[model samples]
Target chain A: MSHPNRLNINVENLAIGYKDRVICQNIDLKLASGELCAIVGVNGVGKSTLVRTLGNLQPKMNGEIQIAGENLGAFNMDQLAKILSVVLTEQPASKNLRVQELIALGRQPYTNWIGTLTQEDKRYIQTNLKAFLLEDLKQRKCHELSDGQLQRVLIARAAAQDTPVVLLDEPTTHLDLYHKVQILKMLQQLAHQSKKTIVFTTHEIDLAIQLCDKILILDGKTNPFGTPSDLIKQKHFEQLFPSDMVQFDSSSGSFKVKK
Target chain B: MGSQRSYSFVFAIIVLALLLAFLLNVSSGSVNIPFTAVLSGMFGGHMEVESWNYILWNYRMPKAFSSILVGGGLSLSGLLMQTLFRNPLAGPFVLGISSGASLGAALLLMGTSMITGFTVMPFLNDVSLVIAASLGSFLVLLVVLLVANRIKDTMALLIIGLMFGSITSAIVSVLAYFTTAENLQRFVFWSFGSVGNLSSRQVALMGAIVGLGVLLSIVSIKRLNAFLLGENYAQSLGISLKRSRLTIIIATGILAGGVTAFAGPIAFVGLAVPHLTRQIFDTMEHRILIPAVFLYGAILMLLCDVIAQLPNSANILPINAITSLVGAPVVIWLLVRKRKMLF
Candidate 1:
C-alpha cells in the first residue's frame, strides 16, 4: 500500500465547462492520498462534470491539474492511466462480454497491442475479483447481473486498473439501501487499505456525511470545499437545496420539505 | 467436449466441408463426370474424355476456387463493416462499392461500344472491366470515408452510402439507355453475377486482392475490438481512429470491389453471414469471429451454387437470386429475433 504522505493531487484555478457554456469556475482543491471524498449537490449541478474534468476525461476550461507534481498533459495515456482511473455512469450494453473479460479491459493500458493479460495483470484481476466477491460470477455476462452486482463489478474493474486515484460518477445510483452502504464502505476500505484517493458523487448526502472523509458540494452559485464537519461547522448545508420545497434542519443535518 | 476440443471440432468440420464442396463442384456441371474420373485425371491417370478433363481443370476448378475466395472475402468485409459502423445493417453493398463497380463496368462496355462499335472493340475483354470496377469501388470508398468523418451518426453514414449506391446505379442506367443492343446484353449479363464467368487471370487477380484484405483484417484485431465500445472509447485506448478506419475501409473496398468486378454484385452473403457466425460462436471477439465468418460464408455460398444447379430446371438460377433466397430469410429472422441491430 502507498502512503497518504506520498500520493498527492492538486487542482489549481480549475474551470470545467462544456461547449459554449461554463459549468463551474476557479475551483482550487487538493486531495491527499487515502482520502474518501464525496461530491454532493442538488440535481443539474456540475458535480459529475467537475469529477470528469479532474479525472482528465474531459478538457478543463482554464487551469492546470497535476498528479504527484507532474502536469496532467506531461504524462502520456499509459502514464496517466497508472495514476488515475474513472468509472463512467453509462452502463455499457456489452452483454457478450463476461465479467472477467470486462474487468480485464481495465488492465488494457498495461497489456500489449494484442490485449493479452500478463501474470501481474492476472494477479491484479484476481485480487479485485475476490475483493468485490465476484468470484462466482466470473463467467457470467454483465447483462445477467443485478444492478447492485454490476456496480460492484465496475468498482472491481477500477481496482484492477490499479491507479492511486479513482473517480466514480454516482456509484450508488442503482443500488438498494443495503448495497449502497456496502459499496460506500467498500470504497472507504479501499482508500484505507490501498491508500488510494477514492472520490464519488452522490445524492445521498446524509449518508455521505458519515462515510466520506471530505466533501465537495457544488451549489451552482457558490462551490464549497471541505470535509463534512467543516461544511457543517461553516453552516453552508442549508442553502444547497432549493429554498422553498427543501429545508435543511441544522440540528439533524438532513433535508426535509416544508409542510 | 472440452472447450479446446470443441474449437478443434468446429475447425475440422470447416475443413471437411471445404473438401466436400470442392469435389462436388467438380462433378456437378453441364455434362456429368464421375468423381472417380475427375480424381484420376487430376492424378495423371486415364480418364473418360479429353473434353471432360479440360472442363474439370480449366472451368470448374477456377470457378470453385474463385467462389471460395470471393465468398470468404466478402463475408469478412461484412464482419469488419458491422463492427466499424456498429450497425448490423452495414455491409459492402451499403457503402456503394458494388454500385461503383457496376458503373465502371458499364462505362467500359457502353463507352467503348459508342466510339469503336462492337466489331472493333471485340478484342477488349474482362480485364478492362475488372480494372475499371476496382478503381470505381476504391473511389467511392474514399468518398464515403471522408463523409464519415464529418458525420457522427452511424445511421446518417448508412443513408449517405445508400444515396451513393443510388447515384452510381443511375449512372449505369443512363449508360444502359444509350448503349446499343449487343453491348447492353453484355452489360446486363455481367451484372447478374456468375461464379463461372471468372477466367484464370481474373481468378488470380481476385485471389490477390481478397488475400491482402483478409491479412490486413487479421492484423487489425486489437483495434477492431477497441472499436466495439465505440469510437471515442477506441481513441482513448491509444488507437488513431482515423488510421484504423482507413485500413478497414480499404480492406472492405478491395473485397467488395474485386468480387463485384469479376463475379458481379453477389448480394446478401456479405450482409447475412457475420450475424449468423456471431450467433453460432456466441462470442463477439474478432479473433474468433473473423475466421468463423469466412468459413460460414464459404459454406453458404457453395450451398447457394449447388441450388443454382437445379435439375430439370430450364434456366439456371442467377447467383444473386440464390443468395437472396437464402439471405432474405436469414435477414428477416435476424430482424425479428434481435429487433435491434446486432452490433
Candidate 2:
C-alpha cells in the first residue's frame, strides 16, 4: 500500500534492549495515527522490545523517536501521559485496591495535587467500567478478581486515561480463548471509536491476522516488521516456529501441522 | 452499584467518629477533665483555672495534638510506602526509619553525660533527641534508596528494609550492653514509646516536620496512585519513579522519625492504620485513603493512649504495651484469614 497518511510516529536507526543485552538494532519504522497494529514474532525475537521502544517504555539507543513531529523526550511525564498510555503484563501487587480504584489511576494525569477525580473524569471512569463490563465488580479487590477480570480492569484503566495511543503487552496472556477474543474485540473497537493508535504484542499470529489492521512480523533474524499478507508472501513465517511440523498456510492464513 | 451518597455517608461517619475520638482523647486523662472543661479549654476557657489550666495547657493539650500529628504522619507515610514499593506490608518501620530513630535515641541517651547537653537550648533537652532522630532516619532512608536502585523486586526491597531494622536493633543492643544501668533504663523507657513526654516547643517542632512531610505526600498523591501500577507504569504516566520513591522515603522519615524522637517508637500504628483505612474507605484512591488513614491512625493511637491510662493512679502503662495488646490480635487475625484463603 501507499505510505499511510497521518503517520504520527517516526523512529530512526533505533537500537533497543534490556540490561546488558541488545535485542534489536538499526530499526527504522513509522506508525500512522489511528492505525491498529499487532507485533508478531517467534519467541525471544524482540517483538516486545520494539513495541516497548515505540511506546517510549524503554530507552532507544543511537536514535530518536518523534511523536507528532516532536521528540519523545521533549514531552514531560504528564504531557506524554496525555498522548500515550501503557498496560504491562504484570499484575499490580496492590491486592486491596478495587477495580474502580485501579481504573481511576488512569486519570492520574488530569488530577490536581491531591489527585481527586473530577466529575468529568468520574464520568469517563464510569464509562470504561461499563464498557469493560466491570460495573458489577467495581468494589471487588484486585486479588479477589480472576486473571481475566484483572486484564479487563487494566484495559479499563488505559481507556480511562483517554490517551491517543494505548500500548499493551500480551493483553491476552493468561486468558481463556473466549476472554482472549473479547479483549481483542474490545481493542479493535477502541481503535475505531476513540481513533486511538493501538499497538500490542502477541504470539497468536492467526488471531492477529484476522483482527489487526496491520501486523509487524519479526523472525529470529533480519526484517523485524511487515504486514500479515506481506510477511506471508515473503515466507518469513517458515522459520518462525523452528519445526517443520507446522506450516504457514497461505490460503486460510493460519498455522497447521504436517501430521 | 452503590450510590455516591453511600460513599459520602461512609465518609461522614468516619469524620464523626474521629471527632468523637478526639473529644474522648481530650477528656479521658488522669485528671478526668469533663467534656465541658475540655471544650471550654479548647475555646479559651479553663474550668478549675489552677491545675486544670496547667494540665490542659502544659500537659494534655500538647500531648493530644502531638498524638494526632504523629498518628497521621505514620499512617500516611505507610500508605505512601505501600503504594510506592507496590507491597502491602511496606511501612516506615518496615523500611528501618523507625529503627534508625531508635538507634539515634539510643546513641544520644547512652553517649552523653546528660541528654539535654546536645541541644541548642537548655530547657529543651528533647530537642537534641528530635534532631538526632531526624538525622538517623534520613541516613537510613539514603541507604534504602541506594539499595533500591540496585534491587528491583518489591519483596527484595522489603527484605532489605527488614535487614536494616535488624542491624539497627543489634547496634542498639550492643550500646545498651555497654551503658550504665540508669542510662539503660532511660533508653529502655524511650524504646517502649510514650506520647506524654514531649514539651511544648518539642511538640511544635514535631508538628512542623510532620506537617511538612504530610503536605509533601498530599502533593504527590497523583504520583503515589501511579505508583500502585508499578514503577514502569508510573514512569509511563509521566511520574519519575526515582522522584516519587524519594518523596515517599522522606515523608516516611519525618513520620517515623518525629514519632520515635518524642513518642519513642510507637508500634503497629504505621502497620495497622493503613490497612484499617483501606478497609474502611473501600477504595485505594489516595485522596480518600490518605485521610482515612490519618483519621483511623489518630483514633487507634488515642485509643491506645486511653487504655494506657487504665490504672488511673500511678500505674500508666507504656503506650507500646497497649498498642501491642491491641495490634497483636489484629495481626494474628490477618494471618489466620490469609491461611484460610490457601484452601
Q: Which regions in candidate 2 have their CA more than 4 angstroms from the true location?
A: A1-4, B1-8, B29-49, B112-124, B145-159, B179-185, B338-343
Give the i-RMS of model 2 in Å: 4.4
Per-candidate TM equals: 0.87, 0.90
lDDT score, residue B246, model 1? Answer: 82
Residues A1-259, candidate 1: write the lDDT tens digits. 3456564678877788898688787676678889998888887778888877877667888888887768887877667767777777876535556787677777766777667667898889889989999999988777789998888888987888888888899999978899999999999999888999888999999889889988888876557888888899898898886688888776777778888
RMSD of every prediction: 3.8, 3.7
Best by TM-score: 2
Spell out the clash pairs found in candidate 1: none
**Number of backbone-clashing residue pairs for each candidate, in the order shown:** 0, 1
Give the true-contact fraction for every prediction, in order.
Answer: 0.14, 0.58
Q: What is candidate 2's CAPRI-style docking category based on DockQ? A: acceptable
User: Clashing residue pairs, candidate 2?
Assistant: A77-B238
